[model samples]
Target: MKNKSIFLLVLTLFVIALAACSASGAESSSSESNASESNANSNSNEVIDIVWYPNESGNDMKASRDEIGAIITEVTGKEVEHHLTTDYAIAIETLINNNADLAFMGAVGYVEAKNGNDAIEPVVVPSGASGTLDDAIYHSWLAVDVDKQDDFKVDGEFSLDTLVDKRMSFVSNSSTSGFVVPTSTIIDYFADSSDYGDLTPEDLMEGGSLFSQVLFGNSHQGSAVNLINGNADVAAFCDNCVENYVEAADGEENTVGTVYRVKEGAAEPFNNVIGEEFILISVTPVLNAPIAANLEVLGEEDFKKIQDALASDATANNEEVFVPEDSDASGLFYKTDQERFIPVEDAWFNPIRELSN
Candidate 1:
């Protein structure tokens, strides 16, 4: 009878020990799950800093930058710190130094950044139409002042040869549409001698070379203004810039300048033209700038979050941010219209890289 009692006591002890071990395991699992949840919540609330290139400066853009920051915050569920760059070179520098997580850069800036530092990746590009991102190209124009339109005529037809020995203005030496493409076109067109085959980019910029005097107005708007004010006889600028200037004219009788078409053997030449209207002297297919991310600093998961957020319907449907408007509070990009941010790879900008080279 004593042995039977001992067996029962041993069995009771075994059951108690088993229950205790099971409870301990359940408690450990619960604690691990709670810790994971806490960490996730903490990460979701982290703020992300983004740098914006002040391609356009004013009180209007400052307000728009704030609004864009808010949109990125809401869409990505992370805080946003927006840094406005002073110039194009500074914008790329910020990314290279890892001072900023992302930047909105022109095609030339993108190429410069990619070449300078190999730690960047192009995230997205603004879409102008319903097509591939590669087709989202803009045109550049060589504009002449309204008063000097007759000076560029040859037998009453448009002639680029007339631009030789004329004072000219350009947006910037590194500018894609305003300087690079247009300058390359001019160099090729004016390559008459053996030296033309070996002319350097710096040669084109020198006074009394391709032009009598070369002036960089620093910005496209500034270049246009330089032409209007007679600081230059001709200006290298963008196609959209002319439209913006004319729209802001408020129907003034005296117009600003005219964009001319380049005659390079077209059967129907773009004739002598001047005024608010654009006559394409040379049209360059230029891709709109892109927003790139620093891959070394941003993780894959977070990068995916930002990419998804930017391409979301929320951003696309937000008219105030996507569409351009005249008001200061109307947002920064595509304010007059809506643009969808499409995903792009680094290879997408290879064409631009080649062009720059």
Candidate 2:
């Protein structure tokens, strides 16, 4: 009986040791599984960086950008960080430096980026129409307040030549529609004109020599505002901008300015003649602003993913992403007023680059 008790105690000790060994092995396996899962989650949650230049200000701009970022996060399954540049040059530089994976830029900005770094390429363009991206064109206008119509018009006809001794507001010198296009138009106009046929932009813009004074409004909207308030006699502006200003006038009659419309027959700015549109005048050839990606930062697979997200069927129909907060759709970014995004190639903007040069 004594020997039996000793054997039973030995058996119990062995059983406890075996159980402990099994428990430890199971714990080790579980730890490895958890580590593997953590690694995967970390990889999936990588962040994407984006940037844009806000041509306009207000809370609505922030709201729109946030909503777009949310959509991108949902589509790409990655965290998205967005930065708004202080100016057009900064926006271009953001892409050139590869600080931003993607950027929304005007043709002129894109041109600058392309010249600075060939790695930048256009990925998508906003379609103003549901039909095609090619339809997404905007205009540049030369406008004067109603109070100054007599100072510009001769016998009910608007004259571009009258602009020579007036106070003028121009959007940013870097602006495509506001400055580049309008200046190109003006240069072409005088270059081919009978009266000032031999003139050049340098001769025209010599510090109050082009007009009595030249003011930089710094924005399309700001240019329109300056013209409406009588701070300027003629303003280099855009089509959508003037419409928004008129609407903001709140039923005030005659707030509509006399706009210089570009005649279609102009061979170049030289052939361009001014007509009185009473609000918006000549249309600069439409500029299709684009969102581009830096090839060095965004892999081909990831670039395609970003493109798919913006062009996705679901995004096109999302009112929160595309719809304007106000009745003036033209005042909104995307200016398509929520139209779908379409694929675009770099060549599409080459004409703009040539014109800008």
lDDT of 1 by residue, 1-357 (tens): 322212323333333221100000000000111111112222223655566554444334555455556655554566666665446566677777666667776777888888877888877676655423433656676767544667877887667788878898887776777777677667666566563555556776767666789898766766766776677888877754333234322222222233333222211111222233333344445666777887766656667666766666566655544654454232445544445666676766665665576
lDDT of 2 by residue, 74-176 (tens): 6566666666544666667767876666777777788888898998988776665543543466666776655456777667676677777778788776777
> How close to the true structure is residue 292 of candidate 1, measured as C-alpha lDDT?
86
lDDT of predicted model 1 = 0.57
- The Cα local distance difference test for each model comes to 0.57, 0.58
How many clashes (backbone N, Cα, C below 3 Å) per candidate? 11, 9
Q: Looking at model 2, which ten-residue stretch has the lowest summed lDDT?
A: 21-30
Q: What is the lDDT of candidate 2?
A: 0.58
In model 1, where do residues sit more than 4 Å from their true spots?
1-47, 192-197, 240-245, 248-280, 324-332, 335-338
Q: Give me the displacement of residue 337 in model 2, in angstroms.
A: 8.9
